[model samples]
Target: MNSRLQHLLEQWSNDQFTEADKQELIEMLRSASAEREIIPVLQDMWEKTEDEGLFSEEHQQTIIKNILDRYPAGELPDKKEIVPTMYAIHRTHFIRRWRWAVASSVALIIGIGAYYWYQHMQGKRPVDMVQSTTRVQPGQNGALLTLSNGSQVLLDTLQNGRIVLQGGVVARIRNGILLYEGTGSEVQYNTISTPKGRQFQLQLSDGTNVWLNAESSIRYPVTFAGNERLVRIIGEVFLEVAQNPSIPFRVDVNGSTWLEVLGTSFNVNAYENEGAIRTTLQEGSLRVVGDRFNGHLQKVLSPGQQALTTKGNADIRVFDDVNAASVTAWKDGVFDFNNVPLEEAMRQLARWYDIEVVYQQPVPKVQLGGTIKRSLPFADVLYFLGKVGLHYKLEGNRRLIVLP
Candidate 1:
């Protein structure tokens, strides 16, 4: 508002100030009563960046052009994305009017022109064309190792390359994953844990690839030593077990369900909170020990079929067009919920988003049917739910409120 300040800003536009003047102005921003009150004047100075001075001037126009180049108008806007917001704000503040303002008084801020441009160009908006977001969370080295001496180390730490040798085995952490190589005859036990809002994949000593879902842990031997290879899993895991018929591989969970497999690909969904233990075979046969009474309770399974065990004898059933992709989408980075109830869908969301579940209304009447990106900021999931016709709101960045 002061003529003196306006004069100084005008001089700045003419490239009269030294670098010290720029530093002084920047420092004033932190101390001034109305620090941003001077911004309009400073913005005028940026016009100098466009037309270079004989000595020096503003290169702002060139710089903005470069930054905007990194982001082009793409398909769908990720609901929880910041890029669009940044672009929107940037367009709002610049590129508004080419109306030549001969007087320096009206050119207080450089963005006034662009702000008007945004106001007029509102209706002809670009629509969603690309994927809103990638429906998968990045993989994390979420392994927790319980040592032979009853000690536990979170393997995800030691982020850099480090070798931890124990029980005649060499376990290394490259980046975040725990890599192992065995040398000795002794079998040592270790456990890998994935907390809420996280997941992990590991290769057991017997060459079984285990994909553990959120809020889960799997305990297994460091090396397969003798006749049998055994492991205990809590929560859920997709197993691609190695084949060795001579020595039976067993997975023990709960009290009744015991899985015996010989070289096969299968999945076990046995979360502690869930009432049933489901063992779905993808390739080989697994005998389910439903009742501790007899070994005969073991049921065989073929591809495209599933076995459900509930304290008693396990039942095997076939499915129509088994949801292979949706069922195993977590391994590939997705939550493919096709016609699943909100209560059931929230279970997966609760684990991945690391949030507590509390419904605000009669469980939503709608069924969730879509694939959502796991890595997106949790709100993206809720936003997509709304976009898909569900009525819900976010609370405290950690809760979802469903409105009836």
Candidate 2:
């Protein structure tokens, strides 16, 4: 056994190596002679991710041959081939990592960081490693529409057309978007809710376009009335307020904080589970106010700014140079994490996939930074998280046991 290879492989598995050490490992793989020995050792280490009988000798040989085919025999390949081979190695180990089960508290696969190359096939035979029976799918365009009289409609299955007629306002679903037209003679409240694994869009009677995030709800009047236009929200939403200077648009969150706007395009994340309510402005302006017994504290947010507040908190902090794209990426079907904590990132995974998170040990203080498509399976997201040294296992059916 090569002590250098073993030591480096161990360090590499734990992501404890430097760039120089990684380069050394790459050089070792370049040699067909060295690869012959390294492949078996790596395979032996990776087999820990799978249970008995799941990984076979034939599969190991096939994977080895597949990796070897990328490099020329008895000759060091060029940079292009070398880089791809490294990725292929990483991909293969990642694929293997997902088949893990925690039979004991101590992780059996201590030699993680192995990549498994997998081709995700949707609607086909579900992957067993993903626990297909209980695997949660990503959030989709869906919501529950509650009419003024309390009649409920599942917007996802509801066909496009005039869906509701209440208080003289005509509610229609056009191309998957719920829209309300005409003025209501009387004030009536309608609420649209996006469940844990769903989202939807709406156009209010005033022409404001609103995008709701998963696990969010927005309550507004069927038509504008009185001195001002008001709406209530919980969770996250992106709004493009229609210009109506005569009647300012106000967003009330949990009755403790609110945003007043004449006309603006902004995103508000008021998820009850999150630490703070974040209001990010993409265009125009708005006043974020936190209601307090000693009068309300307010902050004016310009384009490209974000205000952070909490329910009943008098102080509202503003972050100027925020990643607005990251703030609203969920609306665009992506998970963008920029220096986000492991707990926060997992919370996002939990909501979008409708899974519960369980920590066997104290949660690690690790920050992840990247963008991943929210459409991937829960296991696929776990694989991406694994790349950043965060290990997790899917428990029973709906719980994810995160490992340190």
lDDT tens digits, residue span 1-404, model 1:
54556654445445464557544533443344533565444445334333323311123334333322221111232334423333332222322232121122222222233333433433343222112122233345466667777777765656756555575677766555566786656756778888886677777766788888888888888887778888898887898888889988988876668888888888787886677787777777777677646767666666656777765545533343455556777777667788766777878888876666777667768766756556554434554576667886545545556777
Give the Å error, residue 153, model 2: 0.9
Q: What TM-score does each of the candidates earn?
A: 0.63, 0.69
- Name model 2 segments beyond 4 Å from true: 1-116, 119-128, 292-296
Full-model lDDT for every candidate: 0.60, 0.71
lDDT (10s digit) by residue, model 2, range 48-120? 5644444333544453433322211122234454434443332233343433211110111111112111211
State the displacement of the C-alpha of residue 309, model 1, in Å, after optimal TM-score superposition.
Answer: 1.4
- Alpha carbon lDDT of residue 162, candidate 2? 82
How far off is residue 12 in model 1, in Å?
Answer: 42
- Model 2, position 179, has a per-residue lDDT of 87
lDDT of residue 40 for candidate 2: 55
- On TM-score, the leading prediction is 2
